[model samples]
Target chain A: MAEAREPAIRTRGLNLWYGDFQALFDVDLDIARGRVTSLIGPSGCGKSTFLRSVNRIIERLDYVRTSGSIEVMGQDVLASDVALTQLRREVGMVFQRPNPLPISVRRNVLFAHRLHNPHGQSRAEEDELVERVLREVLLWDQVKDRLDSLATGLSLEEQQKLCIARLLPVKPSVLLMDEPCSALDPEATSAVEELIWELRGDYSILIVTHNMAQARRASDECIFMLLGKVVEHAPTGDMFVTPTHSETADYIEGRYG
Target chain B: MASPGGDRSGPDHLGREWWWDKIAQVLLFGGGISAIVFIIAIFVFIAQQGLGYALVDLDLATYFTSPEWRPTSEPEPVFGALALIVGTASVTGLAMLVSVPFSIGAAIFIGEFATGRTREILKVLVELLAAIPSVVWGFIGLMVMSPLLMDVFDVSVGVSVLNAGLILGLMAAPIMTTIAEDALKAVPDGFREAAEAMGATRWQVIRQVVLPSAKNGLVAAVLLGVGRGFGETMAVLMASGHSINMPTSPLDQVRALTATIAAELGETARGSDHYRVLFSIGILLFLVTFIINLLADMFVRGKKTAR
Candidate 1:
């Protein structure tokens, strides 16, 4: 039924190496457009590496080698001259640590735009963009007046929201979140999960999460991996209630991570 | 005699405790008095010898303002302290100008970035620099750096303020680097990681996050270095040329107060006005060093409070 829809990102025979140690084996996966896909796996599994490869973030690490192709919007990102900065702007990320800039909240949001868009938007336009993104993240009310305050001074949850706001100003086609709620409290976690759910209509998102419940609650499609290889991929409801793979079933059932 | 075993030691024990307490008290008092006596004796000696000329003959402002060092023929013998003051101030100032950036930069490089064997090598280098005697450094400045600089600048005479400044700056660099690097390293890694994750380049992270967070430590490093520079006498004396005149140019020969005291005290006849003038220079040196250390302490305290 979902075959008609375009796949926003596609990975084929993807393998990754950190020097002699291979972190990821050959893997093939398709992430559909306008959906939240959560990569769920045990620790040291290639789920995060796979997600990073989708946007070429792992390539930034020294001596990291990857085989096969990650095609973003049907263009082979690995093969082409697509600049990492340009790709990063199109495929923005929110890290596990709420990595807010040391600068003010306003500048944090504006920084991506400044680097990616050299034409330089007007001050009014940038301010409006910051406000709009902050509102989308449900952070505008808390940060609307004190946009100039240092981003680090915010509470952990607000800092995460500020990070999301920062990513949105770049207008990414797909957003990658690497365990974004890992540093947040339950209330903050719910807020972020809700934000992701609300944002599903506008952008394709691939979230790497260990929280099984979060994957069930927020993702439309789920991919389960064990030891750096994708074990199963299916619709979230079926993947959770009746997993196709025994390892995935065991993982989802809390038998083993 | 039947019950004496438990009770006969009372008087001796009490006396022993009392005697020990008395000895401890005497030692503490003696130590305190020794420090005070030494300090007071130096001040009193300086005052006893130099006070008459400073108060009666020479005006207070003139002593600080008059640049002429010669006391040849005036009835009052025109003994102004301006040459000494300017000489000391200029040497210290030049030392700071050379030391500040080099030390801070070296410190950041060693503390923040270097690793394993490379870091160990740098550490050893710093330790070796520190272990070298100040007097030896002074001699080196006199024999090597002073002449080299004069030749490089193509001046007739060597051993000027410039030579002193360069040597002092080089000597102070390792000390500053070690202190500053330790301070920078003490800053948590979280700050740098956060900055980098925000797409800040390495230099930007260093300038904005790392430096600002380590501001207090950097200031303290500079303070420690400045104190070391101020107290460095032998090096300044040997390389500063001991020319009683003000430093008119980088090549011009000049004398620091430390150099003047070292050079003139030998030639002057005992109890002469010139002998007393050398003593006055010592007093001035003491006062200037005291003021600088006090300022540095104040700076460190102010920074701590700000943080």
Candidate 2:
């Protein structure tokens, strides 16, 4: 499997800081093609920070300094040759907050699709893609009736699904979600987890979650982190059942968060 | 969360406290009502005295379109307010045209692109400009602005429509920049972030997201600046040439309604056509200011929840 499978993203000696405060340090990680990897850690442990660095979103923030080499599809992402716009297009993100723009739901989903499409798509093709993505997120039935309504009026869960559906129309090769279900109830969480599982068939998915059980349920492999360091990484079942590191064991046992 | 001491009872004497509270309430309500009454009374008196001149003139052609504004013995030479209105509108329009774009651009620069020390310096400079009295601005217009304009454009008195407009535009700039900066600051950071996340450039974000979101406030600022320029007395008197003749061009000398009212109001005999003419000019000033203010209010209020 290692010989046949290629890494979609490879990070080496990654370090990030907000002013003088270090958030991520000397991290080396690999993300495989067409896999779901969940990053689980306590709050302020750099899970979301790592997720943001994947697409240079952190670069937009002031007082943030990142020193790292991130390679996606065997190209150096930080290099000038690899355009940030193109990199972002290839690697899409779903934020912690469900920020569906104060626009119609159909427009919200179709915006990402039209981003790189200079000639744009036909109306029929656009509608079909929107409907297909909405269905993939299990939101078409509920929202198909009022796709014209403002996306902000939707419930939090529905908004999150809409955000996910919005990204799907873009067809990103990698999807990074930063605690996409933390704001949701159990039923909504289950729906999102199922959607994540379904999405794994097409694209590589990296999700940051504080919910350890959610990490277990949604991910193929689990990366446990503490204090800006990766404590352990293994197959989800193996990591949860027999974590190699004592810190991972304690974290999984809920002995100490 | 109990108090450390065991003194739970409130107020030593409730009767005196309640009476004091009632007095405070009465004072507050009285102050509020007095302010409202004062504003209403001014408007009522102005309208009552000025309405006769506005309405009693039956011939629209004779009152509005007639070029002559001479007062005579018969019926006291009915003085029309149309020229005054046109003068005020024209000057205000010129001032706004010069000020709005530059002011909004200054606001965007300070609010969005400026660094720490530069932004602070610009803010302080704007406030200092606002603090300068109208008389001082007018003096600058007379001594500095007028001569510079005369040299450049070769007008007779150096005090023409252009001179008054340039001075008014300068005076209005601080107000516009400050108000527009406040409005731009009120826009949520989320809009900027959203635009940035979409791979939009810095200029694109300011244009498409921030400006549109803050459009109502910016428009209100510009309208308020127009009102300020229209009613401005000292600066207009000093720089508008005080010519009774209608303005033929920007460089040609002209008088503003505000300057006319200020220069003539004290000497004109009460209950005469001349007196009524002054009041009529006041009424025109009031109407122009009122309409602009109302438009500003509508834009500011309507745009609050437009998103």
Candidate 3:
């Protein structure tokens, strides 16, 4: 039924194992397009694993084994014929910690763009691209004069914004963020949350967060997961007011993690 | 309790502790300072002994510019080191050319691609290569490599610059591979994951992300390898034939600075001009290695500051 509605990302029978220990158990999810879907769960509840699985980054670990299907825009991303590079280009990721390359801020923004589009861009085009993305992330004016400076010199908040900006050049359909603002202070968190709110309607955003308030404040829809299974997925307001499952209610009320 | 100083008070306890502390401090300081003192003493001694002959007695211009290196001749003994310098440069250059690609490739393979049992085995093998003594490597070059080169190139003499370079490359590869692999391994997993998330291929991630992050370390590795190649003696002494001529081709028989010193140091009498000239060559080798290490240190410091 969710698939019929043309969701941005749809997963079916998604199972994952780390060596002998299974982390996910037949997880089926349908994340809608042009909406912010927040995945909230306790630690080690497979939230980050699920996000990494969507982009096939989980495969980087030699011990990780994943099963079942993940589809992005009607294409089966888990299919053997699907090129990993192609899947990744369409589905961008923001990690728990902002990992900007040690290169200059401008080069960090252009890295993925250059890799995906090897045909090359002119210097003026690169400048425009940098400006547009940095502006979109609300970081252009602060970082404009220091575009040539090393990205590692930026503040945690600016670095996280830069990380998000770097993903925009490839024009990914779905953005998977795994605790993107977990490292920031309260002020920086709100700023990043505002940026995420601004980014809605243009890209389908799936964020995993431990902060219950963040999930409620930032997301249009909230997905509550527990013990590697989805407990509830509902509108943000409805989920907070009246959770269908007791586990979701317990988690939201901070009764028990 | 009564103390030997006859103070028998709390202040006496403090005084006793301070006395022991001073002794310990002096001992530790001496231990630390001795290393620097020894290095400075060696440098001063070498300069005093060698500079008298190299700079004061002999023409400094001829020592650097003239190719003729005859130390024993009628009326005039030429101490020019131009040929030996060229020999050292060419042999080291060739060794680098042969070893750099292989070492870096092996390092990348071991550090990035290899996993599980294969990585362990390759690492052990590299360690074994490094453990092999310099003399053994020289023997291998003299017995095995020289003949192979002679047959392959159809040259009259098997021991040539090419042979020395090849053998020196083998001698240097383990050091290069081990250090370069460590450099590659030091690249954080986050960079790799970030690049992978961007849909970059494994090779692309290595080239665009990993290598750039590890650039300073890699440069340091190469500089260390160059220093190792430059200072290596036994392998070059055995395989290079020690023909004191400026090498025109890799196949030409040549003499390196290390090989020159090793071959002539024993034959020259103590405190003779020839002996002091050998000391001068040692000074040159010292300066070269020191500069390379200094450059490597700068790169390492730069990497630290950037991070």
Candidate 4:
């Protein structure tokens, strides 16, 4: 059993609201550490909201309200004195769209590291870090010669890779990807899926995706959410073959989204 | 017309939308080209009015170097413009110093910090500030700002370089803030979200990502403000004291080129050297504003292609 190991993220009785509208119900989940777990559901099912709740990025909206607890790497992030920057450093995120800074590729990779280490590392150390992270994202060979060029100039796939690369320098314990490849083409999607797979075991990744096939192929564990509640959490093969709930089965069979 | 099963004999249409569309196209084209036509017409008119004096008998040496501008003396009327040029430059330079910080700060607050009713209210107030007439601003400079400056700096005269600069700076700030806010708004919110997600503090995100991302547009905003300050006449005329002195300090009184033409053009007889020289000043003002505007436009376009 994996009982001896601590979970990467633990949510207990978590509820969320946006002004008058409640978006998430009292949901509880324990995402196993260092695994690729995909949250799959229909539109407005709150899968992405649940993912955002863990890192508390949605708090940027003034009207958003949350209760209960979300602990990232065993720290209760919802506590007032908890420094968000520190939490964000531990739990990095990639958005639905590849949102790389309008800066050089080399700087993009080093953005988070610079945030954490204000005094900064020397040029050789930074160069090594950039190379190491870019290589980890499988993007170094293509962008090696153009490190100083704008990251925005890269293709969507490369941009997405760069976005992921930018997060790695901070050595985040968890990476939450909200449909990271939805904007990418099929070829790019598979390429990014492979890259995501390559990143597994090194970092705990909770990915929210709409594609059933991608969920089946890419993730080790799968969770099905409906109406802001977790419907099922099982191994990817078992869930696809024999879903625990009819909603999960219907969702997988394309009966209705 | 042809039957469904039969071959067509000639090209034909059932709809009557063709002629209306043609008329609309002609009308829209005329509307689109009116700006270019008007600009060219104005330039030609200014050139025609000033060409005789500027080309034939302008005393190029005295016109540029000498500060004496006695255009109504009995024996000999000097036509030097060095003082007027410096006056305009100094007023506008001081104005930029006062306006840039206020404009950028207000823009950042409106675009990045303020929300809900506060944002809407601030935006409306800024726009109202811009809509206030230039003459009214001149009145404020003459009646209020000048006296205030005199009290603050312990100067004998109320209207000086400082007074005009303060008034013009306030006058120019609304437009500058509006444009700078637009520039900041143009930077996609995604960049802010991306930076914030990277453990960057709010200030860090703005300083490192948002400002740099919107740098071109912000520069364009400042340049446009400079253009606004350059062509402004009424406010500069009222606040700049209309003195012909070459200023060595902020307290010294000076006169702007725009003020000179606005003030002396009516008094001078038609076709006189003074009249033609006023038109020459108009030509210079036109050229300076045109170049500043062109540069601003290019910077705005740079932001577009960067994405």
Candidate 5:
């Protein structure tokens, strides 16, 4: 787990602002390939801001502005010539609350695939792709018989898993999740944490969590941030045991953020 | 429980608050039910005025089937309204054809693409366009569209189906745009965010995700526009030539049902068959519009429950 590897996502000199309020300041990180990294910070500490800037989804708000260099899978994602659609295809995202489209499960799963491949494919091939992703997320059996049903009908936990599953069909190398389990119950939270753990080493997962225990157990590397600045980046155990910064120790010990 | 003042304010000001609350409840209830009361009253009045004459005296078959609408004929009036129905149908149909695409496009542009100030300005402009009186629209149709149609299509009559339809379509667009934009807006922002994150382009998100989710509301928008077209009197009466002819072509002169009632109702004697027939036309318009409004309301409700 501690092996030195090439980085999948490297952000250097990253700074972001939302209409004059700076949310992220000089965020620099080199997240290793095929590892689950957790970002832990108090609310409005720029943890989610850092995650969103990776895929540039933060740009959806016109007032948001950034001065940064973000590279995903060794490609300079922030380059002017880069197509956002292609960049997003390579780097998928899961939201805080499961926001599945108001469409059938099958269609939601195939949405990206169809967008990239506008020409038709065989029905059997689509079914196979759908099954493969759902199986990867350990959701195939629960949703096996109801592939055509609306995705919104599924439970929040199932919907969260489906959100992850939908991204796999597009073969995104990096996955960014922002508070994926915050909306779930304690049981469902652990269940989804287990799914995230199983997804490790296959996709580079960058997850933001408010649950300190989830960060301790479910992640390989941990990042602790405060006031839009990264305080510490270490293996989860080391960060929890002997953090390099006072803010990190206080946050980890249930003291002040 | 120990606080007697908390239990009542009955002691405060000699229960003035309680009396006011009771008065408010009664007033609010009356105000709310007044709409229903008025609608029922109007329907009953319309029925009383027209139902007997339409059922017993008028020739139902001829009124529906024949195109001859000579209500003031010497010995015996024909009372056929087939031509007027066709006239209204043709104009409204053409108007729909022209308006639906434009309204949807405007809605997409405003709801999806335009940002803060531009979006607000466009909305204000749409309302401004809708604010122009129908009579003023009629004037534009008669003066502007009429000549333009005659010159472009090599037709003698300017106030034909083409002229009236163009005017009505323009008239109906602002309302359709407003409602369609609302439908588009009702689609949650989460859906757009999820789709866009999956690399769906702006247009793709609108067409595949937003439009499907809001289809019921969009259809309701179009239906309301159709109802507006059906009930419109001044514009169609002024723009559409009030000739009693079954319009066979876009260039052919026609008279709408609304235009006929508006044009002839004033001249007819109080209890004459012609006056009674106009009231009957009112009933038909009422029923058509009532159905359209009901369907639109149902569609809006369907959207609410589906979500």
Candidate 6:
């Protein structure tokens, strides 16, 4: 399986602290290429922290410190020499809520593209790019008639989809989603889950979720975490059916979070 | 159905409490309503006195068109307001030109870039600037800025439209900065995060996301600044040389509407045409500031609803 291939993201001895409070232990992980890897745990288990660390977004907070090496596409992202903008261009991230710029839908989709490609694009090229990305995220048919409308005016589901669509134009290799569907209803969650599933084979995705059923249903590989430590990382079916550790077993069986 | 303790109090107690509540409500409402009433009364009084002269005693065409503004001449007192209008416009326009960019930049720096102790210090300094009185600003203009202008521009008299504009701009900047900073702070952090995650630099995020989100508030800030510059009297009167002529250039001496009214209102005879003309200038000034403030309110409201 392609899941057995080289890792898209590899981290070693990833320890992180916020101020004096350590949030991540000596963690090690190898998320496979072209696979949807779900990081699931109870609240405050540092699942989101782990996901954010992959893209180095946690460092945005002044007090955050990490002693780790995170390699994306075989390049060390933790190195001081690496340009942040360049690293981020190769790795896109979506937040807990859908946050498209308060601009028109078309501009929200084209913002990152224009930023990365400052030489500029022709009108036809921009139109095609917008449509292509929107269609990939299953939003083109719904919002095609009102591309100039403000993105914030859309329903929550469409806004989430648009947020995802905006990332595609940058052509990042890996997409990190931090509870991307947390703000949506159940039906909208499933819709976004399907979109994420569809995107799996083309892009390596790391999704953090507290929903066990969502992790089981949507991911190819699942990593269980507890107290900033990884308990088990296995194929989704195997992890659910026959967990190696008692913690994982208890968690899946709904014995305890 | 007797209560544990309330049975001891009769309906009269409830009635007394309700009566006191009504009195409190009336007092609060009256205080709020009186402000509006006073505003309307002032407008009515100014309009009645001013319109009587403008419509009856004055030649409307010469009042509006002629640059000559000699009101105390022997046979026929001329009350041309064209020069005063130009003076007000020039001074306010120059003030906006000087203040807008600096205020916006300062606001962006304070709101978006600075952090921790630096942010706190800058904020306190800005508030201190706002607390300084207009009369003190006028004093500063008279003593410090006027001499600087005289030395730098080599003008005969230091006080000119440019000098007044520079002083008024300084006076208006604190308000502009404070409001603009609030608007910038109001932009969601999620926008910055999203832009950054999409490989945008800090500058790119600010320009494309933060600024566009805060556009309405920024425009409102500029409008408020313009209102401040328009209505300011003492500083302009003290620093503008109070010349009653068309301001040919920024360096030329000028007299604004506010300055004219302040300088002449106390000296004019109570029932004379000159007194009514001063009131007419007051009406014009009031209307200009009123329109600017109205526009600012609309933009501020637009920002709120857009969110």
- Identify the candidate with maximal DockQ: 5
Q: Write the per-residue lDDT of candidate 5 for residues B1-307, one digit (tens) a residue.
A: 4454455434454454678899999999999999999999999998888889999998999999999988889898899999999999999999999999999999999999999999999999999998999999999999999989889998887998888898999999999999999999999999999999999899999999999999999999999999999998899988888798988898888899999998998999998999999999999999999999999999999998887
Each prediction's fraction of true contacts recovered: 0.12, 0.10, 0.85, 0.88, 0.83, 0.78
Off by over 4 Å in 5: A1-4, B1-14
Report the Cα RMSD per candidate: 6.6, 3.5, 3.1, 2.6, 2.2, 2.1
Q: Write the per-residue lDDT of candidate 2 for residues A1-257, one digit (tens) a residue.
A: 37366577788999999999999988888887899999987788898888888888888767898887888777788886767667777888887777776668998887656665757889899889989999999999999999999887899899999988887766778888989997888998898888889889698999999888888888988888889987787889999999999989988899877
Candidate 3 residue runs with Cα over 4 Å from true position: A1-4, B1-34
Taking all chains together, each candidate's TM-score versus the true structure is 0.78, 0.89, 0.94, 0.96, 0.97, 0.95
| The best candidate in terms of lDDT | 4
Candidate ranking (DockQ, best to worst): 5, 4, 3, 6, 2, 1
Ordering by lDDT: 4, 5, 6, 3, 2, 1
**Candidate 1 residue-wise lDDT, B1-307, digit = tens:** 5243434655555555577999999999999999989988988888788767556655667668887776555565666667766776677778889999988988877876676688899889987898888899899987888668868988877787788888888888888888788778866676665445444456766887788767777887887777777667789888887777776777666677777777778887777777777777777767766776677567556645543
Can you write out model 5's per-residue Cα lDDT over A149-226, one digit (the tens) per residue?
999999999999999999988899999999999999998898889998898888999999998999999999999999
lDDT of 5 at A26: 92
* Cα error, candidate 2, residue B147 (Å): 2.6
TM-score: the better of candidates 2 and 5:
5
Off by over 4 Å in 2: A1-4, A80-82, A113-115, A118-129, B1-12, B15-34, B57-63, B71-76
**What is every candidate's C-alpha DockQ against the true complex, given to 2 decimals?**
0.16, 0.37, 0.81, 0.87, 0.88, 0.81
Give the top-scoring candidate (TM-score): 5
Q: Residues A121-170, candidate 6, lDDT per residue (tens digit)?
A: 99999999999999999999999998999999999999999988998998
All candidates in order of TM-score, best leading = 5, 4, 6, 3, 2, 1
Supply candidate 2's per-residue lDDT for A100. 78
- lDDT string for model 6 (B1-307, tens) is 6565554577555654577999999999999999999999999999998977777878889988999998899798888999999998999999999999989999999998898899999999999999899889889888999999999989878899999999999999999999999999999999998888888888898998899899999999999999999999999988888998788888999999999988898999997989999998888888989999999999989999988
